[model samples]
Target: MSQRQRYAIIGTGALGGLYGAMLARGGHEVHFLLRSDFDHVTKHGLKIESHLGDFELSSVNTHATVDSMPACDVTIVALKTTQNRLLEELLTSPTRDGGVVLVLQNGLDVEADSAAVVGADRVLGGTCFLCTNKVGPGHIRHIDYGRIVFGNYSGALSPAAVRIAEEMVTAGIDANATDDLLLTRWRKLMWNIPFNGLSVALDATTKQLVDDPHAVALIEKIIQEVHGAAAASGIEIPETMIDKTIDSTRTMIPYDSSMRIDYLNRRPMEIEAIFGNPLRAAKKVGAEMPRVEMLYQQLKFIEAMRCDTC
Candidate 1:
């Protein structure tokens, strides 16, 4: 990859739209794969209102299908894990150009899926600490933190990873390449397994969950359970990270997590990807995540019931 590489954003929702628009704004050639927003974004382009700044692209290169999109150097998979079944087709479009595929979704072993399609050498997994919402067609509202930590799924850092992170930094994103991809993933899960699960299971915002004594206790237990699983998997998360995740959420703006939003809209939340995968991984490693299991069960039940009115 060059200093200015051609990029394709596979899922142009909140994450893709915001980061892809930022890349375009930073003067990179970005192609967006949009569905419902294809016509809207083609005409109106993309819009992002962020704490860092506000910007819009009046003329965006948009595509409605993977076959229609041109080959690019970096293809970002921002689709929800629920839509991962569509990845093999979408990724082939960019990998044909001999570019790397970055899996920018949540949960463990996500990159493995991408690696299976594109080969591990060409696959990178990124963890996003970004808070954003697609407020309208071609519009994204940035709420809080917007940092991305990415690493090669096959182990060891590569020059491409470094260059890509540097390019994103130039694009004004807090991006870094980590040498330990799996361990970094475990770190990310420290926050995600609890918050994303509870947000849907408890039907509570980050603030509300952290504010209530009972919720906070449950949240802590879930976090510890996740940490235990990580340890069982041979990746030991630092002790201090537990407190940091809690403090950061307590101070950040109150917000509804992505899973919560999915539930509220009656869309399928990432239950299997976020919870099922980790639990099974833990079980294989002989680790029992009773609290995390409870939370996962609660979310599964809520997922079954949240659509009762439908």
Candidate 2:
């Protein structure tokens, strides 16, 4: 952006709070759009407990509503995909002329919603390889990995995108830009399809799921199905990605996935964005994910039952 652009974070949850706090701590002007923690954050500010190092921002710029936030050069959407319906208002409020919407979310075929608001050329996608969650109001616990890979939804990596990645690095984050958005999404799904789904389906933590031999085999099957789906869509995810993802998880701290937390907290799960959308993309190209499809339906049923009970 021009002359060190301003930033606005739409969701003040785990990923959003961690990123926005780092940016603000790195001497950037960041306005956080908050719902629940507005009073706490606006008063006590944000507390980030990270694996790298712990830090706190005692005074932060926070707003309760989107309309109250200033128009910024880059607006990061760190919300779960279940809330994409608000993209129309969320994308417009914090973005000024020539500003871009950076989507730090999961799933495929999802950027179209942001594009529909701000035009395709101005929508960027970020794949977050971070293990983080909100432990309490305005407090985030970042246990492992905080690297972000950014790419333009229009398949053109702009100088602004690279600048944003570099700024993230300046904020003590590991980040970079990529030309292949689709490839990055597919690679993420390779890990999400198995760990996130099984975490909820079996009611297990990442360590629990990866520890059992039988469960590991099942995860392998789900990964293979996701790989096949990607291949049919003309995206070639490396075969070694499977082992790499699983191996990385083995070394990760025992944790619950976002889906597991959602299910437990009675919050909505992002089944459509994480599972359904990818399945449909594969279906369009005559690819089927029997294993992943079965898991998807199970999640849908669980989600429906959970909502009904709640």
Badly placed stretches (over 4 Å) of model 1 are: 1-3, 307-310
Report residue 19 deviation for candidate 1 (angstroms): 0.7
Question: What lDDT tens digits, residue by residue, belong to model 1 across residues 1-310?
Answer: 4459989999999999999999999999999999999999999999899999998899999999988888888999999988888887888976655699999999888887788788999998999998999999999999999999999888699888998899999999999999988888888888889999888877789899899999888888888888888988999788788888898999988888998899889888888878888999999999999988887888888878775432
The lDDT of each candidate is 0.89, 0.90
Candidate 1 backbone collisions, by pair: none
- Point out where model 2 deviates above 4 Å: 308-310
TM-score of each candidate? 0.96, 0.97
Clashing pairs in 2: none
lDDT of 1: 0.89
Candidate with maximal TM-score: 2
- Model 1 poorest ten-residue lDDT run: 301-310
Question: What lDDT does candidate 2 reach at residue 118?
Answer: 93
